[model samples]
Structures are given as C-alpha cells and as structure tokens.
Target chain A: MIRAEKIFKNFGDQAVLKGIDFTFEAGKTNLVIGKSGSGKTVLLKILVGLFQPTSGNIWYSDINLVSADKESLRKLRMEVGMLFQGNALFDSMTIEENIRFPLDMFTTKTLKEKKDRVNYCLERVSLEGNNNKFPSEISGGMQKRVGIARAIVLNPKYLFCDEPNSGLDPQTSITIDELILNITKDNKITTIINTHDMNSVMEIGENICLLDKGKLAWQGSKDEVLISKNEVLHDFIFASPFLQKLIENSK
Target chain B: MNLNLFYHFGNFVIWQAQIFKRPENGSMYYKETVRQMYDIGIGSLPIVFLISIFIGAVTAVQFYYQMAGSLIPAYYIGYIVRDMTIIELAPTITCLVLAGKVGSNMAAEIGGMRQKEHIDAMEIMGVNTSAYLILPKLIASLLMIPILVCAAALIGILGAYIASVPAGLFSSAEFIKGVRSFFIPYNVIMMLVKAFVFAYILTGVSCYQGYFVKGGSIELGQASTRAVVYSNILILLADYIIALILTA
Candidate 1:
C-alpha cells in the first residue's frame, strides 16, 4: 500500500495539488480521476517521484519517498514500473528487446534466461508471436500491450500507469484495463492509474480518488459512483448529456 | 544574461556529477558506447573529409596567390598549409563542423526522447537517465573526435599537395620537401589537446541542452540550434585559450 499524506505541490505561485491525503491499496486498480488540469497527472507524477511535492510525505508502505536518499530511491525504483500515456516504448527496439530492457539493465540473467522472460512477458500480454516486430509496425492497442509487457517484465511491486487509455478506442481501452486489472490481481501489485476516462472509472475503478481544481473532491469505489452525492464527481463523470440520461434511465 | 549564465553553469556542473556516477551495468554502457562510436565517428567521416579537403585546397591556393612574386619559396605554401592544418585548422575547424553535425544530432535525439517520455520511463525503471543517455556519447566523442581530427589533418595536407603539385604551381618534390621541413612534433600534441577539449565541450553542451529540454517540437528545435551555436562558440574560445597556454 502507498499512502500520500497532505501532499501539496506548487509550481511557482500556482498550486497544483492542495494537501491531497489518500491511500492506494495493494492488489487493486487505484484510479486518480479528474478533468484536464485537475492535478491528476501532477499527483501521479509526485507519487512516482518524477516531481517532488512542495510539501508532504509520500509513504510507500513504511518508507518516506519524499526524503529517501539517492541510493534508496534507486533501489526503490527497481521495484517500480510505469506505463506512460504515449506507451514510451523505445522505438528503435523490437518488441522482444523492449520487454527485455529492464532485465538486461538490472539482472545477471543469461541470454537464454532473458529471452525466456521476454517470451513469457509477450505471451502474458497475448502478443506471443509478435516478438520481432517494431512498435511502429504494430497497432496502437498492440503498442499499449507491449508497454504493459515491458512494465511487468521486471515483476515490479508497484505499477503506475499515466493515462493508459488515452487515444485508444473504447473496445481496446477495455482490453487494456482488464489486462492491468488482471496483472494487479495476479502479481498483487499496488497499481495506480491516472486517467480521466469515465468508462475506466466505471468499469475497473475498484478504488477511485476524484480531484477537482487540485483538491480531493471525492473518493469511493465504482459501486459508490452511481449513488454518490458529490457534485464534483457528478459533474466530471456525467458531464455529457448522454451519460446523464443513461444514469437517469437506469435509475 | 549574466545571472542566467551562472544558473546554467551551476546546473551543468551539478548535472555532470550525476552523469559520471558508477554505471548500473558496465556491459550495457559498453554496448551503448560502441553504438555511439559508430554514429559519431563513422557517421561523421564523409562530412569531415569534404570540409578538410576544401579547407586545405583553399588555403594552398590562396597562399600561392599571396606569395606569387615574394621572396618566400613556393614550397613554403605546403609547409604553411601543413602547420596551419595541424596547429589550428584541423582541430578547430573540424570540431566546429562537428559541433554543427554530431552535437546537434545528439541534442535532437535526446530532446526527442525527453519530449516522448522515454527518459522518464527509464528513470522510473531505476536507470540513471543522464548517465545512460549522455555518457556513451561523451565517451564516444572523447575517443573518436581526436582520431577524426588526425584524419582531417592528414587529408588537409594531401589536399594541399593535390592542389599545388598537380596544378604545376610547384613540383611534387618541392611540396613534399616543404611538408618534410620544420616538422614540429609538439604542434601535433597541441592539435590533440584542442581536439580533446573541443570534444568534451561539444558533447557536454549538446547533451546538457537536450537532457533538460522542456515543451514541444519548437522548443526542441531551439535547443538543437542552441547546442550547435553554443558548442561552436565554446570550441573556438577553448581553441584560443589552449593555443595561448601551449604556445606560452
């Protein structure tokens, strides 16, 4: 479990995350959802140590990430994996090579062992035979899967995904979401996903934190979303007329 | 402007500390260094050759015209070309050209990676993005730029010979004699020192520009331009300083 306590982030005079206190539980798809510019990405970045909060403590279990020293941070990062919004796969590398990168960097495994791990990751992502293909040669959905394969190749304890469903078709987005959800459950990984996709928030948002204008506006599960009286959450989730109508009809 | 300069210099010094840390994996760095060697060294050969030959030919032809009826022998043109190429033109001009070519390329490549979140991805994977991205290029430049400068010097001398001897401005024997005369071995050492310093400046400046780049393609383009411009200016400045120190 990762706990963010009173996290306050400011860029210059502009505050982005205002004293956000939350806990992301282990083995669950913990979602940080909000509209654009709602500090979702900033909060995610701070949690992952890409950006330091102006004030607060980020407790990755017992360790305080905000005060961790260089060696400790490096060691901690080895246990962490991230899937970027853009997928961030090395364009120059083949799918197999991309998946094997972490292992190659951090392990003493022999070539055969590394190759075996790469194949296993590929198979796990259901891209089993697409090893030699480049990222550009694959579809966007396939690229997202490759990103997931690379992320999980190292068997990280903590997984952070930033906008995993952006630019993906709704059908493909569900597939990616299921893949992440299953991976979290299977590995017991503490997974944090930052997205504004309402479909994702409704579908696999086991634990969701809603941010409105840099403050935590609402927090609950997918089950609580429909019955929640949080105005910020309602405005965000049912902002579109179609979604609002669907909710009324279902009621 | 002065404050900004200090700020950048301070940041650059601090950033270098990050880049020279012990590698997470030696073999990975070694492989990257080899790849960078091919890119910065072999990939730069044709341009270096083309520039060096033109520099030498122009110097020879211009010197020949200047000394046509002077008391100085025609052979002095070859000697002058040789010395000039070795002491100044070869290292300085070659590095200036490379600052535009290899340096800018490094900036664009790393800047593109930054814009694409590749560097952040590596950082999240526990890789020292600074070291992994810049060190191999630095190592490659240190190892390759001097060799390229030496090649440029030799090719420049040959260009002088081809322009002068074959054109009947002087006999092959006179040009060869001039090249053989006043062979200051110390000047070659000076050339090498300039090459080493220029190599560091170009690689470090370019990589620094790229690694810290922010924003979109327009910003990246500006960073690339700054890499070449700053590298060239620093190379020339260092060339002067080195020349003074060594000559003194």
Candidate 2:
C-alpha cells in the first residue's frame, strides 16, 4: 500500500494540493477523481515522484518515497510502473520492443525468455498478435493496451496511471478499466489511477478519493457515491442538467 | 538578460551532470551509441561532401582571381586552399552546418519526446532519462564529427584540384607541390581540436535545449530554433577562443 500523509504542494505562491492524507490499498483500484483544475493530476504526479510536494510524506510500504535516497529511489522505481495519459510508447520501436524495454534494461534474461515475457504481456493486454506494429499503426485503445503491457512487463509492485481513459470511447474505457483492475488484483500491486471519467468512477473505483479546489473533498468506495450527502460530490457527479433531472425524477 | 544567460548556463551544467551516471545496461547503451554513430556519420555524408566541395571550389576560384598577374606563384592558390580548409574552413564550416542539421534534429527529437511524455515514461521506469537520451548522441558526435572534418579537409583539397588543375589555372604538378609545401603537422592537430570542441558545443547545447523544453508545439519550435542558433553562436565563439589561445 502507498500512503500520503499531510501532503501539500505549491507552485510559486499558488497552492495545488492542500494538506491531505490518503491510503491507496494494494490489490485494489484506487482512483483520484476531480474536475479540471482540481489538483488530481498534481497529486498523482507528486505521488509518482515526478513532482515534489511542498511538505508531506509518501510512504510506499515501509519506505518514505518522498525522502528516499537516490539508490533507494532507483530501486523503488524498478518495482514501480506507470501508464502515461499519452501512452508514451517509443514511436520508433515496435510494440514488442516497447514491452521488452524494461526487461532489456533491467534483466539478464535471454532473448527467448524476454520474447516469451513480451508475448505474455501482449496477450494479457489482448494485443497478442500486434507485436510488430508501431504505435501509430494501431488505434488509440490498442495503444493504451500496449502502454499497459509495457508498464507490467517488469512485474512492478506499484502501478500509477494518469488518465487511462481520456481519449478512449466508452466501451474501450470500460475494457481498459477492467484490464487495470484485473492487473491490480492479479499482481496485488498498489494501483492508483488519476481520472475524471464518471464511468470509471462508478465501475471499478474500489477506493475513491475526491479532490475539490486542491483539498480532499471526500473519500469512499463507489457505493457511497450515490447515497453520500457530500454536496461537492453531488454537484460533480451529476453536473449535467439531464443527469441532475434524472436523479431528481428518480428521487 | 545576463541573469537569464547565467541561469540557463547553470541549468545546463547541472543537466550535464545527470548524463554521466552509470548506464543501467551497457549493451543497451552500446546499441544506442552505434545507432547514433550511423545517424551522425553515414546519415550526414552527402551534405558534408557537397558543402566541402563548394567551399574548396569557391576558395580556389577566388584565390586564383586575386593572384592574377601577381608575383606570387600560381601554385600558392593550392597551398592557401589546403591551409584554409585544414586550419579553419573544414572544421568550422562543416560543424556550423552540422549544428543546424544534427543539432536542430536532436532538439526536435528530444523535445517531441518530452512533449509526448516519453522522457517522463522512461524516468518512471527507473531509467535516467537524461543519460539514456543524451549520452549516446554525445558519444556519437564526438567520435564521428572529427572523422567527417578530416574527410571534408581532404575532399576540399581534391575539389581545389578539380577546379584549378583541369581548368589550366595551374598544372597538376604545381597544385600538388603547393599542397605538399609548408605542411604543418600542428595545423592538423588544430583542426581536430576545433572539431572536438565544436562537436561538444553543438551536441551539448542542443541536448540541453531539448531536455528542459516546456509547453506545446510553439514552445518546442522555439526550443529547436534556439538549439541551432545557440549552438552556432557558441561554435563560432569557441572557434575564436581556440584560435586566440592556440595561435597566441
């Protein structure tokens, strides 16, 4: 599990993430959800060590990831995988090579062993036969799958995804969500996904943390979302007039 | 403006420090280096050759015109071309062109990767993105650029011969004698030193520009332009400094 205690982030004079505490449990999909400019991305970036918090402690299991030494940080990173919102696959490399990159850099596995692992990852993402294709040759959904394959190829203990369903269609978003959820359960990895997709929030949000104006507005599972009396949550989830009307009519 | 310059300089120096870390995998670095060598050396041959030939022909033509009816021997044109190509033109001109070609290219490639979050992905994968992206290109430029300068020098002399000898401005023997005359071994060393210095300047500046790039396409384009412009200015500045120190 990863824990953030009293996290605060500032850019110049403006604060992005206020003092907050949250736990991302292992073997479950933990989602950080917020509207635009709600500090979800900043919080996620801080958790991933891409940005430093103004003052806070990030505990990855036993280690304080925020204050870890360089060697310790490097070791921790080797066990951590990330899926960027842009997919972040090397455009010059094929899907097979992209999946095998971490292995190639970190493992002494032979060519056949690496190939088997790459194939396994590809198959796990349901991109089994698309190994030779470049990222541009594939659809955006397939590219996200390839990103997942690359992320898990090293068998990380933690996975951080930034906007996994941003540009994907609704059906494909569900598929990607399911893929991440399954991977989290299968590996018992500490998975934290930063997203604003309401479908994702309702579907696989086993543990959800909601942010509003850089502060944690609420924290609960998807079950609490419908019945919770949090005004901010209500406004955010039922923002559209049609959805608000539907909820009122049902009430 | 001076403060901005100092800020960028300091940042560039700090950035350079990150690239010297031990590689996670030697073979991967080696593979990248070899690919960079091919890209820098083989990929750049035609342009280098074309530019060097023109430099030599132009030098010969202008010198021949200047020496008309002068007491100086006609063979002096070949000697002058040979020395100019070696001591200045070959390394300086070739690198200035490469600063535009290879330097801008490195900036764009890395800047694009930055904009696309490839560097961030690599960083999250525990790869030192700075080292992995910049080191291979640096090694490639340092190794291949001097060889290209040497080739340019030799090819420039040949171009002089082709322009002057066959055109009956001077006999082949006279031109060859002029090239063979007053051959200073130190000039060759000077050419190589300039090549090495220019190579470092171009690659380092360009990589620095790209590595810290921020924002969208317009920012990236600005970074790319800065890479070429800054590298060119630095290369020329280094040339002047090297000449001052070495010749003084």
**For every model shown, what is its TM-score relative to the native structure?**
0.99, 0.99
Per-residue lDDT tens digits for candidate 2, residues A1-251, read 99999999999999999997999998999999999999998998889899999999999999998889999999999999999999999999999999999999999999999999999999999988888999999999999999999999999999999999999999999999999999999999989999999999999999999999999999999999999999999989988788878879999
DockQ, every prediction: 0.94, 0.91
Clashing pairs in 2: none
Best candidate per DockQ, number?
1
* Per-candidate local distance difference test: 0.94, 0.94
Least well predicted 10-residue stretch by lDDT in candidate 2 chain B? B161-170
Off by over 4 Å in 1: A247-251
